[model samples]
Each structure stands twice: as C-alpha cells, then as structure tokens.
Target: MSSSAAPAAPSAIPSEVFEPPVLAEVVRSGFVEGHHRGSLVVLAADGSVELALGDPAAPVFPRSANKPMQAAAVLRAGLDLAGERLALAAASHSGEAFHLELVHTMLAEHGLTADDLRTPPDLPLDPAEAEAYLAAGRVRERITMNCSGKHAAMLAACALNGWDRAGYLDPAHPLQQLVHQVVEEAAGETVTAVGTDGCGAPLMAISLVGLARAFRGFVLAEPGTAERRVADAMRAHPAYVAGTRRPDTWLMRELPGTLSKMGAEAVQAVALADGRALAFKVDDGATRALGPVLARTLRLLGIDAPVVDRIGHAPLLGGAGEVGEIRATF
Candidate 1:
C-alpha cells in the first residue's frame, strides 16, 4: 500500500490523444471560442457510478482537495483539533484576517510559531487580500501563506507525538505515512503515485473516482470518527474551510450537510448528505471552466439551487459590458 520508488509522472498525453471529451466551452459573443477537456465522475447515494466521462480511472493528484483527509490523519496521529481549529487544519484559506488570527492562535496554543511552518512565504490567496496587502506595502511572510494553517496543525501533531518537527514534511515521516494509509483506506484504492504538493508536502495520487469516494466516505463515516469529525468541522465552519468569497464556503453555507473542497490545478471533490459524490479535473488546468462544469454536474444529480447559479456565474466581459460566458458542454 506504499511505495519507496519515485512517483510516476502524470500522463502528459495530449487531450486529443485519448479523445477525452470536452467538459466546458468558452463562448464569447455567443461563439464557441475554446474548449476544456478533462475527466469527471459522479457517484449515486449508494456509491454506484451514475455518470463518468474521460478516463476517470487514471491517477491524478487531488491537490488540496485532500486536506480533509490529511486533517483526519492529523487527528488519527493524536492531534485533538476540533471546530474552527480542525476546519483550518483542512483549509486552503483565503488568507483573510480571521484565518490568520486563528492560525496564530493555533500555533501559540501548541507552543509553535510562524518559524515552525515549512510552507514557502507567499501573498494571500484571495485577490482582494493580496491587493490590500500590496497596497499596504506588506511583503510575503510564511504566516500569510494559504497553507500555513495546515502546516501549523501538522507541527502541532508532531509536537503531540514528540516527532521531529523539522522533517514533518518528509514523505517518510510517521505522520505523512499515516496520512497515506488514511487516504488509501478512505478512497478505497491504492495510491498509484506520489509527488510534492504546492504546499511542499507529500501528495498522493488517486483516480477521480477514488477522490469522489474519499469525499463521500468522509461525509458518511460514523459519528466521532476522524473522517466524520473533519467533515463536521469543515461544514460547520465553512468560512474557515475556505473564505467568504470561495465557492467551497458558499456551497457548504447554502447547502447543509454538503462537503466541498476545490484543489489547485482545477481539481474539485464534493459529497452530499445522502452520500452522492463527485470529483473532476480540468485537463488543461483552466480553473475558469471549473464552475460551469461543476454546476452542470450537480444538475445531473437534481441539485438546482440559487447557490448553483452563484457557482456557475462566470460571465465573460467585453469593454465593461456583458459578452458571453463559459458553460458546460455535457
């Protein structure tokens, strides 16, 4: 269930090589200007495949979509995180003031500091926040990195276990090893590859279907279980999981009991209260296509709410006026 060899490279085959279907189209002035090719999968409440496109079986890095599972791993490794703390542990936060405040609090509670984080210094993840930061002449700092909260939680877990904090990001570390195990178990599949994530942590590769299954497992796990706790914390504190302007937070806020997470490179995984789940990735990594595609996918499952409209509201512009839009193809 683990590998020591170098992680295999993701399939770099051209989108047309396997005839992967178009998931979305960029329409400008009512003309189809471009297409986004990718893979997607949807699972019914019973966990059976209801829809699939492209090669859903192919392995892909789910990126930060794997945070909830990683947070569960931290809990399993003996971190007593809960509520907003647990939610932030599983967040790709927008680096808003509130998120930074809690991150600082978490580090202080655990006798850690910004220096303990291994995430590279970066500006806030939210555009508005980044703009304000630059306007104020603030330079990038490790604590402002979007992944700092997760790193703080990791350091706390390391402290709890009395493990070497310096090597916490190593793939072979005890905590990450446990994370690998939990990921495999929750996804119900063997991790086919490994790599370094944007946050400089080990990344495990699993199929789109496996990613969907993992999200569903989290929502449906027995109460008080690590998976359930992570799901609950994230759902209850949607803002902590992402931020005020993020779709993950929006979707969870509008739809109770829904679990939602989007990762870098246009990866998204979601599960409903009834256990219906889905995962998708844009082959070209065009995040602009993610919204329309995701909204259409939810429609197939009979989910049509105002939030869907909000999520799918990616309008194209022309000289400060409405032009057209990016929309789902199928």
Candidate 2:
C-alpha cells in the first residue's frame, strides 16, 4: 500500500470491540433512575488480575491520573523536587491558599512566574474554595488553575535542561518526549493515542490494566528511584495531590501507604502499599458516580473503613431530604 493511500472503508472495520458494563446505578425514591457504564481493573499484590468488570483492555485517556508518571519524568530530567513541592508537581491541587502559596514559591525558585504557565485560567477545583475566590471578586488566573504546579515544574525542567520554555508543552519538546518515554516504560505498553489535556500538556491513552500496572510499579519501586519518590511524596502530602475535600486526599490520609489520584471526567487510579492497585473510567463521564464505585471496589478488596462510608455517601435529595443514592452494581 502507498504511504498516502486512502484509509480503510467503514464497512471493512470489525465490530469486535468490547462494550463496558454498568458499574453503578442511580436510584431515586426506590426507583432505578439511570446507570453509569465503565471499565475497571484490579491487580492483586502479585500483579495478577483480581477482578475485572467491562472491557478494561480498551485504551482510554487517564487524564490527571497520569501526573505521578509525568512528575517522575521531570525528576529524571534533573529538576530537584522533594516533599510537598514534589507532591505539588504531581498534583491536581484544589487551589487553596496553601496550594497557591507553594505554586508561587516553586515558580520563584525556578526563576519563572505565573505567566510561564500554559494551563488555561480557571477557578479552584474545590467548591468551597471556588466560592470564596469568587466572593473575593477574583477572576480566573493561570496560577489558580489546578494544574499550575505541574506547569511550573515543567518550566523548571526545561530551565534546568536548557530546553525551550515557551514550547515546553509541545509534544515534540524534550520534556514531553521524556514524559512519553517514561509513561510507556512504566505502563509496559505503548501509548495508543496522543491528545492535549485540559492543562495543555500532552496526554497519553492506555488501558485500565496498564494504568493500574503503572501505579503498582510506582508503589513497589525501590526507594531513591524517581517513581518511588513521586509515590512517596504524594502519599506523604495527600492534600497537595488533591485537597482537603477530595477522595484522593481522604483515601491517602486515612489509609496509610496508599497513593490515590483522580482525574477529570470520572477517571481514578489508586495503589496500596502492598502492591494492590486499581484503575477505572466511567464511560458517561459522571463524576458523582466515582465515589460510589471506588468505595465499592475498596470493599471488594476487603477494606472496611469509616472513610469508605464517607466516600460512598452520594445521596439524592428531594426538597432538602435524602431520597436515595447512587450505588455500585459491580
């Protein structure tokens, strides 16, 4: 076939791709209202498949769940980051006062400014924080965006490596290339696709199985390694990775040795100290269903904690009263 040959016709394509199963159901006043379909994979401590629902092998965008891998890539590029700053570098922060302060400090230390960030300006990710920010008459700013820390860290990596800072987010840039390599190495699979993320960074698509495996690798890696450092920092500073009100923060804070991160559009990945890990994406992109699914999955893993109940508390209301809830089905 010639290099510039026409693409295969639609009729030539096979309909063999798997369809995801219903993972959660919405109930209102004892009536099944709707369903959220998705794919999920749980890997046991020994890296074997423990439980799988739907088509976990299909490639999907992992979104901000890929941050830890990207942070490890930045570390490999010789950008020195540790503790909370390292956590922030891998964060989808809530844009609280502390989160904003650290982002400022990181930029200052790197001889960069908020203007260097490529993330589109937006309000805080946390509802309470966003409300307060709006009440203060503040408009959107790049530094206040959830991915600002990651962008600042990217700029720092470029500065340290003498790479072009202006084009840091470009996939062809040295930093993004390194990130792509690291992601593939960690996931043990080639990226199925490349797209621009909400933060304007290059996004890689991989299967749920690969995503779970990558997170497991981070937790199980040796100390002093870039992967382990990113995992440790995120576990140690859960608030920076998410925020006080987030399930990622709550899970990591309440369950020691656990690393958790959630992405936009109802994507989540979590790893335990013992090497058990899981990743999932709700096909409908319904964020409200994530907590219910996660809590159920944790319970299936034999985890019974108060925090699980807290996370699973997704209630439907009827005129200031709880009517029903979103419950996990699988």
For each of the candidates, give the backbone clash count.
0, 0
Structural RMSD, model 1: 8.0
Residue 150 in model 1: lDDT: 92
**Prediction 2 global C-alpha lDDT:** 0.95
Each model's lDDT comes to: 0.95, 0.95
What TM-score, to 2 decimals, does candidate 2 have? 0.95
Cα miss at 123, model 1 (Å)? 0.6
**lDDT for each residue of candidate 1 in 1-330, tens digit (9 for 90 to 100):** 896999989978776546789999999998998999999999999999999999999999999999998999999998999999999999999999999999999999989999999999999999999999999999999999988889999999999999999999999999999999999999999999999999899999999999999999999999999999999999999999999999999999999999999999999999999999999999999999889999999888899899999899889999999899999999
Angstrom error at residue 10, model 2: 16
Please give the distance, in angstroms, between residue 173's alpha carbon in candidate 1 and its true position after superposition. Answer: 0.6
> What would the TM-scores of all predictions be?
0.95, 0.95
Residue 196 lDDT (model 1): 99
